[model samples]
Target: MQIYEGKTAFRGIAEGKIKVYRKDQQQIKREHAENTQEELLRFERAKGEALRQLTGLYEKALKEVGEANAAIFEVHQMMLEDPDYVESITNMIRTQKVNAAYAVASTGDNFSQMFSMMEDDYMRERAADIRDISERLVGILAGRTGSQMELTEPVILVADDLAPSETVQLDKDKVLAFVTVHGSSNSHTAILARTMNIPALFRVNIPLDDTVDGKEGIVDGYHGRIYLEPEPRVREELEARQAEERRKQELLWQLKGKENVTLDGRRIEIYANIGSFGDVAAVLQNDAGGIGLFRSEFLYLESEDYPSEEEQFQVYKKVAESMAGRKVIIRTLDIGADKQVGYFQMEPEENPALGYRAIRICLDRPEIFKTQLRAIYRASAYGTVSIMYPMIISVEEVDRIAEIVGEVQEELKQQQIPFGDVEQGIMIETPAAALISDLLAKKVDFFSIGTNDLVQYTLASDRQNPKLEQICDPHHPAILRLIRLIADNAHREGIWVGICGELGADLTLTETFLNMGIDELSVSPGLVLSVRKKVRETKLGEKYN
Candidate 1:
């Protein structure tokens, strides 16, 4: 009976109430398992149950999005099958009558220990996912389901936080909009919202409890604005905007395959930014010309240990094959302090953004780095696979990594491994990396300027941090200059340069980067066609080529 007003991202409205539930507790009958045989039997039962639950969830995911989209869940299944995830819990249960919380706590401790031994953030994050999943399962055993906000009526979801799985799985037809009191733009939940094209706002400054459930509310996710019950006139205006949004969607369909050349006949490479082999299908679905930047971090995020080179090869091969020889540029692990994966035991620092991450982690862990290199190299045989290193700072670091890459290629050749001759490159992210672009260009095959990090590094502000969020501007003169320098340097050396950051998809920045001489522009799959249209509006040769 009341109306709320706010900037709307997704169109439509629903109303619902909040339902909160606590974590579950699993019953561990320790005393009954005194004998070794009893202990083994108990362990087997627990493992089987966990595997069965994981399998069911994965199967459900496959049905929803198909095998390609379900690929991410495969990693969760692996975690359930992980010896540490299942066995450690079994052991704890057999040795003592620990509740699910205690057992999960014990397993979590051991998980942290194992992660500490790892050097790659990609691998380390997997450990964290395992712990997170395990703890979640333990909560299930303890009857601790997620806070189930009541949806007796279609209502906007109000929560302190939400899981990506929950957000994606929510009945979009019923849920109107989501407003979170706390979350990040990079969280899986946010990614899900973007994927679903849903209107969602994260890090809302106001508390959800401030507005009583069942009372009308409004959220404008794009502008980060909200309104309590508004005047009837305001509601009428919102409904009109929603209608206009529908109109735009209809018009956007005209952009498909319309050509991505700028107004002056300058062609630009518009590709998709993917996280896993699963996302390759989305790229094709969206008719993205190719894969721009494939974040290899997913391989680490869903794993307990370093992915075997052979394992990585299969994944890379699937993506390359799916792309059908279209360019697939893979960026190596970019894990760091703020992105702490349970497995990478980095000494927590006050400033994780500036601390050790990306190239820093790779150099410190050569063996792990080489394993990934070997995998990428092997996959290169299947299709056009170019490798890019992230978070490089100094020319010497580039030299060191390039030397290691050379060693990998030589080893592959000596071993007679089936691999393609892959191109090697570095991401121009750090201020140091940008300043030394000429020096780095002399060492690597190409460059991809990660403007997101470059902006943060140049401004000395952590984009991930709240206080500095306002300062993380990609258009800042310093950031623009750094990107221009790296692009100009790479082209001067006859090496190609592309941008795989958020800025690439930004329509406003398209002409700017094009003017800076970027050859490729990688962005989210949904934005590809639009960016391509923007490119076709520019004259490449006359402006910068």
Candidate 2:
């Protein structure tokens, strides 16, 4: 028996036979081509075929997973068709006078190395994507069919690492769990596993050999361990854990569509915080009241260049129409800080978390801000769409945001573009905003306290730093006091205040939020019903009443 420990991507328990996934490493051999032109033609043909394969994969992933996961293939397709990639491969073929396969391999190696050496973690991960696409093209040129796994029964899949394309192509039913030797919790594979609700353990030192294949294995996602040929006692415990998880899921399902009201009859809105339109399905499945925080930064982050107003409009419109009149509070571009965009040309910051980001970036780059504002305004015509600005510290910032929104509305009116009256709000994240809540509350329709930043800034501790976690308490007296102040001030001004941060989902604080008269709590979709259940069980205006 062998035991391995790793990090959990999702919490679950499963026992199955091990299925070692060996990626097809297509060998590129040097071959002398009589004509360079012929080699270029072959490269073009292979590129076209690779694109067709990617498109097929995209459609399959779209059907199986959601659009967000399927977008991986679309990115792969873009990489294959990128002018820089094409020029590099062609240049090598023309300059070296070698076959298409060798040229592709050489160019891919150089590009992948360049990406691997980058300081940014995001750029470093792109190395894997480059290799995946390059191998696909090389396989096509070599007349080698791509590898496919045909599993006879359910198994725990073991791999060194899984590319996004390979991960999406997996049969969800056949793959009971995932154990990988090489992968980050933030990787695409991890994201897919979470989306599929599968047990996954990454960075485990699991041997990928024929001797280990088909071995009975138990994956404890909660503990991030893989047990090979576990004893009866261990197996029984795992079975019980699995049963408990199943029961909890069933209970959450029953809570769906139930009113989020306290025992004392105080109603609180339980909405979902979504990164993109693709998350709408999960929101509906979980029966959220509405989308409270539609993170608009994803639109900017996912794009190769500045997203045009029309491009942004199409996505915002789709999300609004799909919500079908459910209130959607779309937060304006909150880029920088932790989330950075490549094309934005932002300078290196000594302190990015406190530097020019969110509202600061939007205010400075009004063109980009207005483009998104225009899209939001246009989408409002389809359904309920309200805009929220993040990282506001002063009333002047809110006034500036209002001014830009007004300008967008006027431009739409002049263009004869159909748009609905949209509500404007701001995120009270900084201590300054909380201290001046009364003055700021009158400037916006509502206030959504981003407690993630609020706690970090209030306590003078970096929330991302694990060592400082003890100090970064969301339930701290100061944090709770600030939330109460914001709620009180917003209520006095006839506006509602919500929490759209991680703190809102903390079950322990749900009753406290209710007692403090918080109007809404926006959390991840999976937590909506659970939080709703908490709301129903709590007595209003009580501490353990």
Candidate 3:
């Protein structure tokens, strides 16, 4: 038997014949359809065809995977007809004068890539589904049908990787398990395996070749290992370990309603970050203490034009009410950098991350800033609401924000509009912001460290550039020291501090953050429980003091 280590996406065991997954030619050529009207009509036909196909798949899935899983196809159908998604594809075709296939492909890539990088596991899973539907539409337009796996018997599925679109096309009953060379725990294929109660692994370093296809394979998800043609003795040992892992999984349910307190009696709030009203359900499902980073940029990113104050207010209010008295800190526009909206008409910059963005844009255009502030203030009456400004480095920016906020409140008062108290805070995401955090902390009610950008700026490495992934180290003592600096400054001013970046979800650093006097840690919704578990396990007594 040949053993290979992998990351566990789901915990289970399956021993069966191996089936390798291969897919269709997915290269989409960029071409102009020349006529926008003609291309749009073509896209409509393809979308219609996609909807029909999903309906057929839905019925099939119902028989094979039950209603809960079948609902994915139904949701795919709705997504195919979703106005926003359709508009995105149509707008690209019209503006760029692109072919229907190219439009669908480009728009899908943009949307899917955005969701894939999100911190939330559910949101990440959604990335694959978006790609799946997008590719289906592209395939129809391109007149291409990819490789289809037709299994007559149950097998342990092996692949270099399986796309989200590919998994739904499989016969679930014929798939005993999934083992991929690449994918995350939240990838669509992994989700499918998880739902089916089968073993699944991702990022296995082993080579995937035809030599192993059709051979007996063993997937031991508990210990993150897969065996090709395993010996009988190995199978027997794994079965015993598998049963123990299943028992431990049952204990996972007990984590709910448990306090996020350290072994030494120190407590910290665990919050979830979200982008839209639709994400509130996941936030609550994960049992986050509150919504720490409600990215307000989606209000801009998803809109054709700047969202109206009432439009922004309605969204914020709905989320606030949904939280039902839990803390809701809405971050102001964090556009530019990696997130760009076409309507902004921003002049291209060599380095947008360090250029006119976030607070800079807001300060330059107070009218836009005031509108958002007014909406946030108006929403404050619905629940416990707080407003946070992003990309602030100077005391002057905070002063300007205060001035604008005052103007907004005054306008509301003149109109006799009722709004509740809203706490003000700023993001400490730059070296300059970190250096002067003590001064900045006194001006805001709280401080949220945006470690993703902070690490990039500190290390002079672009966080978005994959080439710098190895070079940009978030664990450098420099980053830890910075967090401690920001946390200390916030505490010195008697204001709470929290991390609302990628590092907040890093379980290894939970104890370090707690010791730094971080009052809260905001992470992706699906990771809330894991971080909470870590927090409860940390023991810091005199060291914290």
Candidate 4:
């Protein structure tokens, strides 16, 4: 057996034939076009076709991966329609009198290379996106039928690396597992594996060439190993392991429709975090009790301009209605940090996360904040809706939000607009907010501790930087202490507290959080069932009391 070692992306076991997945590379030849106008027309038609294809893929991804991960397509659509990108391709066709395919291919190469050479890591990643869109245009120009790998049978698919666009187009059932020659654990492949519950291994320096195709392979995600043409004894052991995994999955399914209560009879709320109205389907499928964190920023991030009050109203209304009376805690626009939109036209900052973000922006720009508040208030008429503000530092910010919300309610009353009772809450993310939670808790009905940012702010680390990924500890004692502190303070004020961040989904600390009197956990839809299983298995009273 040829053994390969890699980092575990997802924990599972699978054995199947190997399939070396190579994306279709369309060769473009430079040719002089007799009519530049006709070539331009051809490029435009292909661009339109590419956009259409992206939309279909996006819809498919929404149902499969939810709106957050599926948003790459929307970004791709914007990149495809970028004026600068279009101008470069058209300029080549007009000036050089080249064929549309050649012009697109050449321009795409230049742009992709330019991005690849950029100093920023995030910008370097954009190089792959640029290439993905460019290749689509060229393929469309060449009359290619599809840009997906066709798998007739289940196999362990190996690749050099996968872009988010390519990974979404893959058929989950047909692929037994994913083994990549190069990719970080946070890569889209890993995220997709977790979401789909598939075995995956990354950074395995395996032969990605066609010669390895059709060889029998085994993926042991639990052990972080890949066995090619395994020995009979090893294969048998792995087969036994696979059977146990299936039995475990069947047990997890049985936990569905069961209460998310601990063995100690402690019943706490379990909710799903979503990014768009499209994610409501996933929320229901996973059987979450409520929508704890409905990120309203996607409406702004995905738009060409500021989303209108009416536009935001429709989205919020659909989500509230879809929840069917379940509590929907919608967080107001948490933009300007990591998620930068060009339309805002804000000046660059040394540390964008600490400067001009979340509640800070909303308080400064009352008109923008009021527009979203009105939409949420209007949607409240459809179902139970609560508002949460992020990046809050003090009680004054909560008071300011209450002031604006009061004006919004008054305006709606004067205009005879129908609205409903909406609870106001602020996120306890900053150290300042956590430190004074007792005072801030009095101003709001609930507190959702955003651990992702809380940890970042408390430790003074950039959460987005890959280099600090290991050093920035989510399980740091300081963060745990802060969570307990916030929960304690909120409890004293007779207000509920919830954790709506990455740490909430951690199974290792499930009992610790339960003992701390955490009221709720808001995690991704894929994790709801697993966390429920953890909660049901824990005996908090017996262990701690």
Candidate 5:
């Protein structure tokens, strides 16, 4: 009977049998030369079936299904075309002459072996993805499930872990909510659940075998709690809370069409921090001002090939056109250890966040940096494009970045490329970035404080690590002071400062940022209306002291 509280992202209380998926699937038998031809036959059949199932997901009827429910479909598509995966399996089958199942098994074990040696947790976790996809292929070859799990009644998926592919195969209309023993906030499965607006919780770290077998219990995704055999009083309280949540959500929807003007006639802008075109549509639907954080991570994810200048330009152009006249602040290719671009070879590090990430990577690879800058500058002609650099620790970084940007601009001009004037900026994530605001202010056009990482680094806590997660507070006094310094410095220099982080959505900090001279707040699409409502309620000259 333990209770935990967190911001309610989704409202629902469901009770169901916990179907756990704990098997890594990577520890399987390898194929030998005697059965190689048979394994190749099996591999081709599985590959073809994988393609067919993927095709079915796109067949208009299935296309409209929830993204969380359609993830396996996408993963299967990747398996069908992934040369690295397919070739490895094919080469093993041809060279070793092993049985079909043994060949797939061998390939899975090889991938798992390789991934386990890698340092990145995310990449290591991807080994599970490989196993999951390979097992699905094996299942398809055996006529077992074919990515379809017969979830008859509403059930909470209780698992030690759930992969993005497994979560995608969930029956969305029937799924009440999901509870997992292990997963982070940024895990693809958790992200997909959020995207589908499903009530899902992770990092439970509890055995669901006895607690959730057949007994009636409440799985509260909002609070990340499980009430096993709850009393009537608890049920009543939950029902009341659910009702209140519904009312609040209705109010948020009603505020969407309304203006976000502050008391005393001041107008404040509310924008959405989006990562892709799909996100742009969501922002537009929510009536956001424009895109604030058009993270270029999606481009890196979509292709193994380094997105050429023209390829990058077209993507940026599409986002710009979608925004129409609204400002689209495009953050230049923010890449590093955390977000590894497969094509680039990077040295492994003990600490990825403090390691070669963002501007640090760009500085080392000037040609790569120049290519992205050139693409951004070229895209500026199509719409309002602002070039932003991530993780700037000193003014020297900004100066070097600006120098590279100028070089790119001159090169583009020499080639007679039509590009517009793009504003340059830096993300105030590090304490150093915020502390030296005056120096950076002189070198950049503006600042967008990424408070998520800022709070983590400022507090000396790893936000992703469960052990130190409790100390990663955005509300800490030091973080607030740094944010204030950044905002004040930008304002004094006649440049605007905006926050593109979870802090922007925090009602308690909204007025604090405004009082500190912050110009704008960029949050998720679902939060825009509520934050806008809060902004309208704020008064001028409200002292934080």
Candidate 6:
């Protein structure tokens, strides 16, 4: 028996035969074609076929996953049709006097390498997308089908890594779990696996030899362990753990529709944070009270250029309408730092975290900011929609945002476009914002403390630095006191305060937050019921009052 340890992306248990996925990079010969015209024609035909396949994949994904995820296929289709990408392949073929496949392979290598070397995480993932699309075109030109894994039976899939396209195209029923030798928790594969509720382990050091193929394996996603040829006793224990998890999930479903109130009769709202429209389904499935944080940056990150007002409006409207009458607090474009956009034309900085980002970028580039404000206001007419600005460190920033919003409203009115009265708010992330919470609270409808940045800035510890992990404690006395101070200041001004960061999802802090009079706790959809359950079981002590 062989045992391997790794990091878990999702918690579940599954035992099945292991199937090692091997995507062999095809080598294209540098053969000169008789006619350059013929090579260009072949490339066009292959490109058209790739587009057709991508469109079909888009529809399939839309049905299987939600729109936000299915949007990847649309992105893939756009990439395949990108004029620059097409020009690169064609120019290579004509200039180099090589076959169409050779041109595609060479261009793919260059583009993929460039993307992989980018500083941003989102842009780095695009490297995989470029490779996926290039492989499709190359396959078509070479008279062979693209890389598709066919499963004859259910098995645990093990791979070095999986591209977003490849991960989405898997036969879900036949793939019980995913084990990748190299991948990050933020990778597309991890995101899709969590969305699909599939067990996954990444960063595992496993033998890559084909000799391990078809071997019986047990995956314990909860503990991040893989057991190969498990002993009878270990197998039984795993079965029991799986059964227990199933029971717990069933029990959680029973908590749905129940108010998130403590035994002491104090009610707190449990909401979900969503990145895109696709995440709305999970929010509803988990019975969250409302969306506390609707990250508007995904639209910006996914687009090749600035997303149009109409495009942003339609998406915002869909999210609002889908939530019924529940409130949706959409945070305006929090880009830069770890999340960077190519067209934003931002300069490289030694410390991007503290540099031009979020509201700073929006305020400097009012044209871009105003377009988004118009979209939010227009969507508000469909249902309740509120706007929140990120990285606000002063009352003046809030004042500036309010001014732009007023401009957008006036323009919409003159155009005879209808909109609703949307509430405005700011994130309390920096120490400066929290310190002057009383003054800032009076300027906005509510306060949502973004602890992810709050903790990092407070302790002067980089959140991404593993060595400083201990100093980045969310439950530290200083952090808790800041939360208390913000809550108190906001309450004094008749404004509610909520935590919408990783700390909000921490079960250990649920009661403490309730005692602190936190109006709401916003976490991922998967943690809604669990947090609600914790709220329902707790009784506020006299010390809290």
What is the lDDT for 386 in model 6? 87
> Residue 433 lDDT in model 1?
80
TM-score of each: 0.76, 0.87, 0.72, 0.91, 0.84, 0.90
Please list the residue runs of candidate 3 whose C-alpha ends up more than 4 Å from where it truly belongs after superposition: 2-19, 25-138, 141-226, 231-249, 464-467
Model 1 alpha-carbon drift over 4 Å, by segment: 1-154, 203-219, 225-232, 342-351, 539-545
Q: Which candidate number would show the highest lDDT if scored against the true structure?
A: 6
* Cα lDDT tens digits for candidate 4, 518-544: 999999887898999999888875322
Name the better of 1 and 3 by lDDT.
3
Tell how far residue 236 is off in model 6, in angstroms.
Answer: 1.6
lDDT of 2 by residue, 432-505 (tens): 99999999988889999999999989999877554576888887999999888889899999999999999999
Q: All models: lDDT?
A: 0.69, 0.87, 0.83, 0.88, 0.74, 0.89
Ranked by lDDT, top first: 6, 4, 2, 3, 5, 1
Which tens-of-lDDT digit does each residue in 451-526 have in candidate 5?
9889988898877655665688788889888888888888788888999988899998887877887888899887
Residue 222 C-alpha lDDT in model 2: 89
lDDT of 6 by residue, 1-545 (tens): 88999989888999999999988768889989789999999999998888888888877776777665666777787778778888998998888888999999999999999988976556677888898899888888878874478888999999988877788788899999999998767776787888898999998999877667889999999899999888999999999999998898899999998998899898998999998898898999999999999999989877878999999999999999999989999999999988777678899887888999999999999999999999999999999998999999988898988888889999999999999988888899999999999999899999999999999999898776645778888888889999999999999999989999999989888888888889999999999999998999999974343
Q: Which stretches of candidate 6 lie over 4 Å from their true place?
A: 74-95, 114-123, 342-351, 411-418, 459-472, 476-478, 542-545
211: Cα error in model 2, Å:
3.6
lDDT of 1 at 421: 66
Clashes of 2: 0
- Which lDDT value does model 5 have at 41? 75
Better of 2 and 6 by lDDT: 6
